[model samples]
Target: MELYKWSAQATGLGCYAYFCWCCFLGSLAEDINESKTSCCCISNILAVYRMKVRATLKIRGDSFSDACVVCWCPFCAGLQMRNELRNRGLA
Candidate 1:
Protein backbone atom coordinates (compact mmCIF):
# COMPACT_ATOMS: atom_id res chain seq x y z
CA MET A 1 0.00 0.00 0.00
CA GLU A 2 1.04 3.64 -0.42
CA LEU A 3 1.27 3.91 3.33
CA TYR A 4 4.18 1.52 3.40
CA LYS A 5 5.95 3.63 0.83
CA TRP A 6 5.30 7.05 2.36
CA SER A 7 5.77 5.98 5.93
CA ALA A 8 9.51 6.13 5.55
CA GLN A 9 9.37 9.64 4.16
CA ALA A 10 7.37 11.19 7.00
CA THR A 11 8.85 9.70 10.08
CA GLY A 12 8.52 12.84 12.20
CA LEU A 13 5.13 13.85 10.91
CA GLY A 14 3.92 10.28 11.12
CA CYS A 15 4.83 10.02 14.77
CA TYR A 16 3.13 13.29 15.65
CA ALA A 17 0.11 12.70 13.45
CA TYR A 18 -0.25 9.14 14.55
CA PHE A 19 -0.14 10.06 18.22
CA CYS A 20 -2.78 12.73 17.81
CA TRP A 21 -4.91 10.38 15.76
CA CYS A 22 -4.73 7.59 18.29
CA CYS A 23 -5.62 9.89 21.16
CA PHE A 24 -8.47 11.32 19.14
CA LEU A 25 -9.82 7.92 18.26
CA GLY A 26 -9.59 6.65 21.81
CA SER A 27 -11.25 9.74 23.24
CA LEU A 28 -13.93 9.68 20.56
CA ALA A 29 -14.69 6.04 21.29
CA GLU A 30 -14.89 6.73 24.99
CA ASP A 31 -17.19 9.67 24.53
CA ILE A 32 -19.59 7.67 22.38
CA ASN A 33 -19.71 4.80 24.83
CA GLU A 34 -20.21 7.11 27.79
CA SER A 35 -23.17 8.68 26.02
CA LYS A 36 -24.77 5.30 25.49
CA THR A 37 -24.09 3.94 28.95
CA SER A 38 -25.84 5.53 31.93
CA CYS A 39 -24.35 3.28 34.58
CA CYS A 40 -21.32 4.20 36.65
CA CYS A 41 -18.33 2.30 38.10
CA ILE A 42 -16.91 1.40 34.68
CA SER A 43 -13.15 1.70 34.49
CA ASN A 44 -12.31 -0.66 31.65
CA ILE A 45 -13.79 1.29 28.78
CA LEU A 46 -10.68 0.82 26.70
CA ALA A 47 -11.39 -2.87 26.30
CA VAL A 48 -14.62 -1.92 24.63
CA TYR A 49 -12.62 0.48 22.48
CA ARG A 50 -10.26 -2.32 21.45
CA MET A 51 -13.20 -4.41 20.38
CA LYS A 52 -14.68 -1.56 18.38
CA VAL A 53 -11.42 -0.98 16.56
CA ARG A 54 -10.99 -4.70 15.94
CA ALA A 55 -14.48 -4.94 14.49
CA THR A 56 -14.14 -1.82 12.40
CA LEU A 57 -10.63 -2.40 11.05
CA LYS A 58 -10.90 -6.17 10.84
CA ILE A 59 -7.58 -6.64 12.56
CA ARG A 60 -6.20 -7.70 15.90
CA GLY A 61 -5.96 -4.54 18.01
CA ASP A 62 -3.50 -4.57 20.84
CA SER A 63 -2.58 -1.38 22.71
CA PHE A 64 -0.62 0.05 19.82
CA SER A 65 -2.30 -1.81 17.00
CA ASP A 66 -4.67 0.98 16.08
CA ALA A 67 -1.90 3.53 16.32
CA CYS A 68 0.36 1.52 14.01
CA VAL A 69 -2.34 1.06 11.44
CA VAL A 70 -3.32 4.70 11.49
CA CYS A 71 0.33 5.59 11.34
CA TRP A 72 0.80 3.30 8.34
CA CYS A 73 -2.16 4.52 6.33
CA PRO A 74 -4.10 7.34 7.87
CA PHE A 75 -5.92 8.53 4.79
CA CYS A 76 -6.99 5.11 3.69
CA ALA A 77 -8.07 4.30 7.22
CA GLY A 78 -10.15 7.45 7.45
CA LEU A 79 -11.74 6.85 4.10
CA GLN A 80 -12.51 3.30 5.06
CA MET A 81 -14.08 4.49 8.32
CA ARG A 82 -16.20 7.10 6.57
CA ASN A 83 -17.38 4.59 4.04
CA GLU A 84 -18.16 2.02 6.67
CA LEU A 85 -20.11 4.50 8.78
CA ARG A 86 -21.99 5.80 5.79
CA ASN A 87 -22.88 2.28 4.76
CA ARG A 88 -24.14 1.50 8.21
CA GLY A 89 -26.20 4.70 8.24
CA LEU A 90 -24.19 6.19 11.08
CA ALA A 91 -22.30 8.79 9.07
Candidate 2:
Protein backbone atom coordinates (compact mmCIF):
# COMPACT_ATOMS: atom_id res chain seq x y z
CA MET A 1 0.00 0.00 0.00
CA GLU A 2 1.10 3.54 -0.62
CA LEU A 3 1.63 5.80 2.37
CA TYR A 4 0.59 8.94 0.60
CA LYS A 5 -2.91 8.87 -0.79
CA TRP A 6 -2.23 11.76 -3.12
CA SER A 7 0.82 10.12 -4.59
CA ALA A 8 -1.16 7.78 -6.80
CA GLN A 9 -3.59 9.93 -8.66
CA ALA A 10 -5.76 8.64 -11.47
CA THR A 11 -4.31 9.76 -14.75
CA GLY A 12 -6.99 8.69 -17.16
CA LEU A 13 -10.45 7.33 -16.79
CA GLY A 14 -11.56 4.08 -15.05
CA CYS A 15 -9.46 4.72 -11.93
CA TYR A 16 -6.13 3.90 -13.46
CA ALA A 17 -3.22 4.90 -11.25
CA TYR A 18 -0.63 7.43 -12.24
CA PHE A 19 2.22 8.84 -10.20
CA CYS A 20 2.03 12.39 -8.87
CA TRP A 21 2.62 15.10 -11.43
CA CYS A 22 6.30 15.57 -10.71
CA CYS A 23 7.09 11.88 -10.71
CA PHE A 24 4.88 11.36 -13.70
CA LEU A 25 6.89 13.90 -15.62
CA GLY A 26 10.14 12.27 -14.54
CA SER A 27 8.97 8.82 -15.53
CA LEU A 28 8.14 10.15 -18.97
CA ALA A 29 11.77 11.09 -19.36
CA GLU A 30 13.03 7.77 -18.05
CA ASP A 31 13.77 6.49 -21.54
CA ILE A 32 16.28 9.22 -22.29
CA ASN A 33 18.96 8.29 -19.76
CA GLU A 34 20.34 5.66 -17.42
CA SER A 35 17.92 4.65 -14.70
CA LYS A 36 20.33 5.49 -11.92
CA THR A 37 21.08 8.89 -13.36
CA SER A 38 17.43 9.67 -13.79
CA CYS A 39 16.57 8.72 -10.26
CA CYS A 40 19.43 10.82 -8.98
CA CYS A 41 18.21 13.85 -10.85
CA ILE A 42 14.73 13.60 -9.49
CA SER A 43 15.74 12.80 -5.93
CA ASN A 44 18.13 15.71 -5.84
CA ILE A 45 15.42 18.11 -6.84
CA LEU A 46 12.67 16.94 -4.49
CA ALA A 47 14.34 15.94 -1.25
CA VAL A 48 18.01 16.91 -1.00
CA TYR A 49 17.49 20.41 -2.33
CA ARG A 50 14.29 21.51 -0.66
CA MET A 51 12.23 20.32 2.26
CA LYS A 52 13.53 16.82 2.90
CA VAL A 53 10.55 14.77 3.89
CA ARG A 54 10.30 11.36 5.51
CA ALA A 55 10.28 9.91 2.01
CA THR A 56 11.95 11.60 -0.89
CA LEU A 57 10.02 12.19 -4.11
CA LYS A 58 12.18 12.76 -7.16
CA ILE A 59 11.28 14.62 -10.32
CA ARG A 60 13.16 15.12 -13.61
CA GLY A 61 13.64 18.71 -12.55
CA ASP A 62 12.87 20.95 -9.61
CA SER A 63 9.19 21.62 -9.51
CA PHE A 64 9.09 23.91 -6.51
CA SER A 65 5.32 24.10 -6.30
CA ASP A 66 4.96 20.37 -5.98
CA ALA A 67 7.97 20.23 -3.72
CA CYS A 68 6.19 22.63 -1.39
CA VAL A 69 3.21 20.34 -1.33
CA VAL A 70 5.43 17.45 -0.30
CA CYS A 71 7.09 19.63 2.27
CA TRP A 72 4.10 21.24 3.94
CA CYS A 73 1.39 18.70 3.61
CA PRO A 74 1.38 16.12 6.38
CA PHE A 75 0.47 13.46 3.90
CA CYS A 76 3.63 14.10 1.97
CA ALA A 77 4.20 11.86 -1.03
CA GLY A 78 7.95 12.17 -0.99
CA LEU A 79 8.29 10.57 2.44
CA GLN A 80 6.92 7.29 1.17
CA MET A 81 9.31 7.03 -1.75
CA ARG A 82 12.28 8.14 0.30
CA ASN A 83 11.80 5.43 2.90
CA GLU A 84 11.48 2.66 0.35
CA LEU A 85 14.71 3.70 -1.31
CA ARG A 86 16.48 4.17 2.00
CA ASN A 87 15.39 0.80 3.31
CA ARG A 88 17.00 -0.71 0.25
CA GLY A 89 19.97 1.64 0.71
CA LEU A 90 19.21 3.23 -2.60
CA ALA A 91 18.69 6.81 -1.32
Winner by TM-score: 1
lDDT of 2 by residue, 15-58 (tens): 11133544543532342222433444553454433333322434
* C-alpha-based local distance difference test score of model 2: 0.38
Off by over 4 Å in 2: 1-58, 72-75, 84-91
Clashes of 1: 0
Off by more than 4 A, model 1: 1-60
Show the colliding residue pairs in model 1.
none
Q: Could you tell me which 10 consecutive residues in candidate 1 have the lowest summed lDDT?
A: 1-10
* Per-residue error (Å), model 2, residue 24: 25
In Å, residue 10's CA in model 1 sits off its true spot by 20
lDDT of each: 0.41, 0.38
